[model samples]
Target chain A: MTSEQPDWIAVDWGTSHVRAWAMTNAGKIIAENGSAKGMGSLAKDEFEPALLELVEPWLSAQTTVVACGMVGARQGWKEAPYAEVPCLPFDGKTTKVETHDSRLDVHLLSGLSQMKPADVMRGEETQIAGFIAAEPDFDGVVCLPGTHTKWARISAKEVVSFQTFMSGELFACLSNHSVLRHSVAGKAWNDETFETAINDAISHPEKLAGRLFSLRADSLLHDLGNAEARARLSGLLIGAEIAAARPYWLGMDIAIIGADTLSGLYSRALELQGCAPRCPDAENLTLAGLAAAYLTLKETSS
Target chain B: MTSEQPDWIAVDWGTSHVRAWAMTNAGKIIAENGSAKGMGSLAKDEFEPALLELVEPWLSAQTTVVACGMVGARQGWKEAPYAEVPCLPFDGKTTKVETHDSRLDVHLLSGLSQMKPADVMRGEETQIAGFIAAEPDFDGVVCLPGTHTKWARISAKEVVSFQTFMSGELFACLSNHSVLRHSVAGKAWNDETFETAINDAISHPEKLAGRLFSLRADSLLHDLGNAEARARLSGLLIGAEIAAARPYWLGMDIAIIGADTLSGLYSRALELQGCAPRCPDAENLTLAGLAAAYLTLKETSS
Candidate 1:
């Protein structure tokens, strides 16, 4: 019942959403689909039956399935052990799960972790590998910005380590839901204000972490324009993260991987941090990571 | 038909809620009456009718009507302009609300304002006065912690100037409501861990803004004990707020105004900042403010 045509599905599952790519052997994405049904939305047993139906057509060709995201954590199937720092993706080991249906070969990737002021990342691992696929054998850090912005150090075929920032989430909360929410002018981006905030934040970086009341007063009393206040808020937070990542990233080459809209903020932040940005098509990169995992599995079995 | 004996009432009026107190001049509170009648619930015109009915019984006697919170704002009735810094209660010229009903000689007191780094406060002006009532008028800073915490520099009867912090609101949104809420430990009051976070945040103060994510990962990766992580998170944020407030508050005596449960956090934070904390009862400080306003009105007319 299987078509001789080979099929591989690559999934970048995250906190809020999931994206799966159907790719050919040469790693060209022929057909694709996505679902709002993110990892957070699913219970442990739901991923298999749900995933099979979406990738069913390609699966008739004996497709191998690969996955990433919180879908790969302790809450995830198989309890993939935390990968230690400076470790590579699929570092000759994978968290393999044999689901209800055996026809699908499923591989869930491992999350990366670091120590003492420690951090870990799950969905970003494949994105890092995908970037590696686009520009093979590249060295440096890959920055992904979001609710949990991620930074990964990559060398050879492995991600040496990475850090995560709850930047996007904090930004959303501070802007819309908190008491300071009413005090700010929302949804408008001004670079001058943003840059000024970044400079002020970097200059008096400690103030970046202070209670947000001064931010409101600055706008109200000091007549800090709304746009500048907004940018300053954004800058103080992002600048603080950059300050933390500096010890790990200084003097290293950096590539920012993610969609254009998603990664633009990180790009601006990189410039402020004296690093140039490289935007990789996240869709293709995830497929590339799946391809790497599938091929690694195939070669090891052979 | 009017009752001659004094009765007690407690009033808690805010932007969204309106309350009235009918009380004896003695500390003991008697009967209380209030309605959904908050400032937001009615138009500006409905205030007179609503307020009259709230304490109709006490109007015939020498009953003193004590009001607190936002009921005395410029928008409430006759606009009360702000008193400048360093002036105590009854010191500044207050704008009186002269209504046709002679029974209600509403003594609208002046709020406080500062010109440099310009800021203004209305209800808190009374709270500051109440705080002063509870303690000797010392040259110090009094912190009123809530959704928007006010840190004021007071000299004698005057609130020289103050800064606002949206600390409580930010903490609520980030903890119980935001996505990061789930990741936070379910424990409270880990002073040791909180102290560590304070030290870490103060040392690399820039990272103070970025330390939130560490709370989640420190637990997930290296088993960062729950209470410690929670405390650390609190310390980091409180430390940052203190750091920012330090510029405005250093060298001034600092007192904290809050109920016991909530004020302890602020006290611990002040301790972290190496500032001894003086906490007076926030009990009916609002009513105390209303009483002060009434007394000032009587003395001024005499």
Candidate 2:
């Protein structure tokens, strides 16, 4: 471990994983670490030790920690109440966590929730806050694709409304657990198959169930290869999601925040839908979100 | 172990289990037995042993054994090639298996497959054939709900056309494997939830992806009960299937051949859609279909 003391710590704790970044006061990253101990694995008391296990090498006697995501959920380190929409992703407030280590000061950022449509997001709100932090005056839709893909409308630096889709989860379950598993067992990308399936799904979204079973039947009757099956499966799901999310991205300035391959696929899908979306790295946005929270904590303390 | 010689044996061998019925010369079932030995678990050579393991007690010096479902699949006891649609479910011709035991004469019936829309059914075809045997002049839509539900058009003793939906499989996968698992872990059926979800899904089928995640979020935010979650999951899937199969079931005489609860659910959904379908016991239909095949075999031999 380096002898140089860190300025503060930024953490993104989710359901199945924890990621931390040690940073200088100026927001320059000094070190990065992570662990499989996510909120889902830890009890309320274990949250502190789980965090320290990963970032102890970089901690000082009295270092401040700014964390986002599920770690701030009701079941996390502490319940940082959600900032209800028609409001900023975070209302410039962080809940202070009581820690056993006298030297540790932790601030957990709250998430965002919507009532009318019944929606909620934990970690992604911080990422949205970070994106807005970079573009202070941004007003448009931000699409975050993941296990539970989210689409949110931002107007005047506040989230107006949002919707969540189980597209990624649906794709995984159908491909790995359903009858389609045998057909789409391997990785092979067929652009034509994907595009065709996507278009079909969008055109006739009601046929989704029938089309899903065809993948299995086609493999048995028509010798449909694994790649084509996989591509068609992905295309059908993404197409269905996009069809449902049309009101959010139709003829609007849109930005998608997600990982590499998934984001690329979303980008291509958007382009196919005649909307060229600006793509950004999801990890960067997460760190920037934690940095924003850290800066706010510092300002409040001073 | 009664010493009375059995006349014939009927089998409904599917992917997960095998059911057999020993009958008299008058087609009266004297004994019924089965085992976990499904087509999926047996190799070509093991199928004979699997069958013998269950029905050996009923075997005589010469016993006629007739089988249907996946047992006649390419991977089953023997390949009983599918009879093309616009034809009888079985063309009075069964694939005879060359058995090691001279006392056993086995005949496997073919399933029905449609080429235009690309669909196939193995075991369900036997159920349909049985229905046709009971109602020879019946001409309408037959709905068989199961792991892979089949909707078929029966006219003039032929399966004119058919479609398969993965509704049951979708429900199982989403409830057990997807993010919705936490929301719907146990059997808690709420009628209101099921009816409401079915109506909504049928009205706006595209919103399915969005509505699915809401189950999880609602459980987290609104404390949605597991019963409601389970009911809604089922409603959403079945509703989508009904919407897609509208062409088959709409304004037509519909008969549902399935197990008790699932068939009951389908009957309710159809009734909600303004169609009261006739509910038939799937087991009875299978046995009747086997009897029809047995009768045909005897006629040809005599």
Candidate 3:
């Protein structure tokens, strides 16, 4: 099997890029490929070519491709309608798109949407599925912090409820576009600054906006160092997010999934709030999710 | 007085623009002028030329130019050292800049600063001065809603203490630069939507970051209108601001000095919170502040 062509490809396609892994029938990663051509950049018809462009070398007859994330969005390759929650993160069925290449059988997984408080998430669901796959009966919270930080409550392998915070986007906008940009220096992290700011914001969430301006005022008047300002800015945003997500994470055993630094930051923030969350690499969870989908699809086909 | 050349000039120089009124010795506006060349755009030396270009026709020998706002900021035309608060908003002993044209005597007014909580206000202090000039015994909170909405405590004709909120800047950043930009349509505003969101935010201020994402989700799932989303965004920000500023405006008489629509929003939000704010035109207040400073300067010179 190692010498032969790969059995399938597992993909995590997001807004800005597509990452695919060639896999053996036994779910081993044979090889990995990626491209900047993501769902955001391509038209509906262009997705097939984009996928083939990245994974063509490893493709063979009946090489199934299971993709997740924005590729299944309404404006993406195909509108894989969302799976409304309080359900298993992965139901083992996905939306399939017609492929021009007969060698490929592509399935795009649907994202999850909540109706009550009104929330939706893409790509992260696959990561959640992967997380559940690892700990089959994991019953608590799984936090995925990224461009949109998600706090999901999982009970007996089902995502009970969740909330999303635009913390990452807010951080980007403030650091790059708002008046705080002047005060916030380069990408530097300070634990003490981050902790203090987080505590201040959490203790007085209403004063968040005022504290944001104080960053600029402090920089101007006290000549606050850029590193501290940058860290404090991150701390403030994350603190507000944690405050909002208290119901989800306060008493729950938690696992955090994302890039190393971000997950670490969330981990530390939660620790300050008295919860120590388990940290997991986001990419691994995404891969595990894609693999689960592919195996389920293979079982159904057989 | 209208026919004769003005005796002096009143200037409100902010980050992006400069507005000036040519005034008689008795504080009557004889003419008005403005230009996009504000403190933000001009270098230190270019400020004089920029000012001259706008009000050059009104200037004659010994015509004193009194300027306020960011023009006196460290990065502005010239640094007018801040006057520590619990003091008068303006002392009239301002930073004087040398001009190539002997016709102008430019006096830049200093802003007010609070050292304890670490806060500062530029153009707003001038507006507060104007508010004071109108009601010499004015005592209470003055709310100035703009890019940086300020809540200033005024008593005995002096600004005692103040705090600044990044509400307006947050609205702009989220609407134009974040993922929420996709859901928010044009510049449409809804009062009912604004009021409801304000109440909701005030009730649960900590959930602000989460509610922000709900606007995006509501658009995705429930087809939240662009107008409603826009208004709700404003409501959420203003709501959080009000909640934080409760201590200042809760039991005190309040006045809102700002642009028409923005001040109206703050006024309505405050009213909902049960404080009926006095709405005063921001420009009028700025003019009155400049006039007061001009009069003080005249008396000192005499």
Among the numbered candidates, top lDDT falls to 3
lDDT of 3 by residue, A34-150 (tens): 999988899989999999888888865768899999999988999998889999899888998998789888999989999989999999999999999999978899999998999
Kindly report which residue pairs in candidate 3 clash with one another.
none
Across residues A1-302, which tens digit of lDDT does each residue of candidate 2 receive? 85677899889899889998888888788888998999988999899899889888986679998888889887787898888898988788989999898778998888888887888999898889889989988888999998889999998999999999988988889888887898999778898898898899889887887788888788888888999999999999999999989999898889999888888888888888899899877888998888888887889889
For candidate 1, chain B by itself scores a TM value of: 0.77
Query: What are the root-mean-square deviations of the candidates from the true structure over C-alphas?
Result: 4.2, 1.8, 2.1
Off by over 4 Å in 1: A1-6, A101-103, A133-139, A155-157, A184-186, A209-211, A218-229, B1-10, B15-20, B26-28, B31-66, B70-122, B133-136, B183-188, B299-302
DockQ of 1: 0.52
lDDT of 1 by residue, A136-247 (tens): 7788778888788887878886777777777778878888876456556666667876776666666677665443555665554567666666776787677777777776
The lDDT ranking, best first, is 3, 2, 1
* DockQ category of candidate 3: high
Interface RMSD of each: 2.7, 0.9, 0.8
Computed on alpha carbons, the lDDT of every model, listed in order, comes to: 0.69, 0.88, 0.89
